[model samples]
Target: MATSARSQTQVYELRVYEIGFFRSADVLHTYFENALIPALNRQGAKNVGVFEEMGESLPKKVYLLIPHKDIVTFQDSERKLFDDETYLKDADPYLTADQATIPFNRISTSLVHSTKEFPELTVPNSAGIYELRIYESHNEGALKNKLRMFEDEFSIFADAGLNMVFYGKNIYGDHMPCLTYMLANTDLNDNKEGWSKFVNHPRLEEIDVHGGIQR
Candidate 1:
C-alpha cells in the first residue's frame, strides 16, 4: 500500500466501455464531456481521465480513470451523481437512448489501490500520448514479485524520460492476479525510446531472473 502525509491512500475506479458502433461512441463522448465529468467534479473527484484505446478497430473501447479519496467516496459519488437532477437531465440523452442504440454494448469496472511509489493520480497533459499497461501473473508469488519490481525499479522509467502517472493493483476486476499502470509522453518517439531503455535496464535483469517477466 502507498503511504503519504495523509493516513489513507487513494482509491481508483477503472471503467471500461465497449461500444457497438461509431454512433454509440459519439453519444458516449458527448455524455462524458457534458454530463459525467461535471457530475464527478461536483462530487469532489479530480484528475478524472477519459481515453480511447489505441489502434483503430470497430467496437471501440473507452477507458475512464477516476480517483477517489477512499472506498466510501467511490461508492457514494455514483449514487449522488444519479440523484442530481441536472446530471440526470444532462445525461438523459445517453441514458434514455433506445436499447438498440445504447452507447455501450457492455461495461466493466475495477477497483484499485494506489502503489506506494506513486500514490497520487495525475491527469495526463493533453499534448501527451498515454499508455495504459496491464501486467498479469500466473500466481500470487509471481504477482508479488512483479509488484516488487514496480516499487523498487520503477525509477528506471523516470530515468528513461517516461512520466508515470500511477501504478496500482486491481483489487477487483477481470483477469485477476494482475496490476496496471499508466505512462505518458509528449512525443510518440519519446514513448518508444523510454520503453526501450526500461526493458534493458540492469534492474530488470534481476527481476527477470526472479521470474517477474510475463508474456
Candidate 2:
C-alpha cells in the first residue's frame, strides 16, 4: 500500500449516469471505455474508476470517479478534456446522438474533498465488487461530527479486511451534506463477511459509547 502526507488532499468528481435502457447502457459504456476514459488518461489522470452498480437498483447506473491533487488541477483537467480534439471526436457518439436515442436519461455529479485522515485514494485490485455508500447528514455540524467518526474509526473497516478505495466529504452535489466512501471485496461472500465483522467490531461499539453519535 502507498501512503502520502496528511495535508495532501485530493478532489474527486463523482459522476453518476442513469441508464434508461440496455441500449443506453451499451452506448455509455462504449463512450467511457473508448472516449471519456482515454481522454482523462491523456490529461494526466492515472486512476479514473468506472464502475457499474451491482444488484437491483432499477434503471441501472454507472459511476465515474475522477480524482485530482488539488482544485486547480481538477478545473484544468476539465478544460483540457474539452479542448482535446480527439476527445471531442471520440465523444461525438454520445454528444451528438438524437434525444430519442440518447445514451443516458440524466447525469448527476458530486464534487468532494478527501479527508485529512485519508488524503490519498487507494487503488483497488482488479478482481472485486465495490460497495459505494453515502452517509447523509442533517447539517454542517452533523457532517463534521460524522467525518470525525470516520477519522477515528475508519480503520475498523481495514481490520475487517474491507479494502477502502476512498472516503470523501461532499463539497458540491445534489446531496450536499454527505460523505461518500467505497469499500470492496473479491466476491459477494467476502463482502458479506467483511461487513459483518465491521458491525460487530468492539472499536465501533467503543466509539458509540464515547459519544460518537449525538441525536
Candidate 3:
C-alpha cells in the first residue's frame, strides 16, 4: 500500500508478556528477534518494536508493538504466521517448549485504532527511552472527550519538545474505555523537561478543560 494510504488505515497490536521468576526470558526474546519480527516483516508489517521493562520489576515484562496496514491485515496476519514454513520452523523452539518450561506466565494483548490526528507510527532514528501510557475514562462519552483533548493538545505536546511515537484509541483489551500512546526521549531528563514545558504551557490551560480521564 502507498505510504499515505497505509498511514490512514494503520492499526496497532500491543502485546505484553509476563515472565515468571526462575523462568528464562531468552526464549521469548529469541523468538521475537530471530523469528516473529522477521516473519512479520516478510508479511508487510514494519517497525515492530520489542521492549523490556526498565529496572528489576518482577514479574518482568516484555512488550511487543506491531503495526498493521489495517484491520484486515491484522486479522489475516495470525493465520499467515502459522502457514509460513520459515516462521514455523524458526519459531519452533518457543512454540514447542514444554508447558513447565514456558517462557512467560501469561500474555495480555490490546488492539488500538490509530487516532485521527496521529494515524501512523514513527520509528525513532536513534535509541532512546520510551514511555507507553494508557489513559482510561469513565465511559465511552468521557473517552471521546479525552480523545478530543488529545487531538487539541498534540501541538502543545510538540511545542514542549515531546517526541510522540504513536497515539490511538483502545478498541479491545483490558481497559474498556481507554487510549494508549507512546513517547520517546533521549533520556529521562529530556522527558522531564518536556513535561515541565507542557504543564506550564499557556495552551494547556485552555485544552485541559476535559476532566476525569484517569491514568
TM-score of each: 0.88, 0.91, 0.92
- Which one is best on lDDT? 3
Q: Which TM-score value belongs to model 2?
A: 0.91
**What lDDT tens digits, residue by residue, belong to model 3 across residues 172-200?**
99988999999888888989999999989
The whole-model lDDT of each prediction reads 0.81, 0.83, 0.86
- In terms of TM-score, how similar is model 3 to the real structure? 0.92
Tens digit per residue, CA lDDT, model 1, 158-199: 788778787888888988888988888887888999989888
- Mark the 10 consecutive residues where model 3 has the least summed lDDT: 1-10
**Residues 1-215, model 2: lDDT tens digits:** 22446668889889998988654477777888999899988977778988998788788888999988777988798789889999999999888888877757888999889977788788876547888889999998989888888766667888898888888899988877999988878999999999899889988877876755752
User: Which portions of model 1 miss their true places by more than 4 Å?
Assistant: 1-8, 22-24, 124-127, 206-215
Reference-based TM-score, model 1? 0.88
Pairs of residues at least 3 apart in sequence or in different chains that clash in candidate 1: none
Would you list the rank order by TM-score, best first?
3, 2, 1
Residue 61 lDDT in candidate 1: 91
Worst 10 residues of 2 by lDDT: 1-10
Off by over 4 Å in 3: 1-7, 210-215
lDDT of 2 at 44: 73
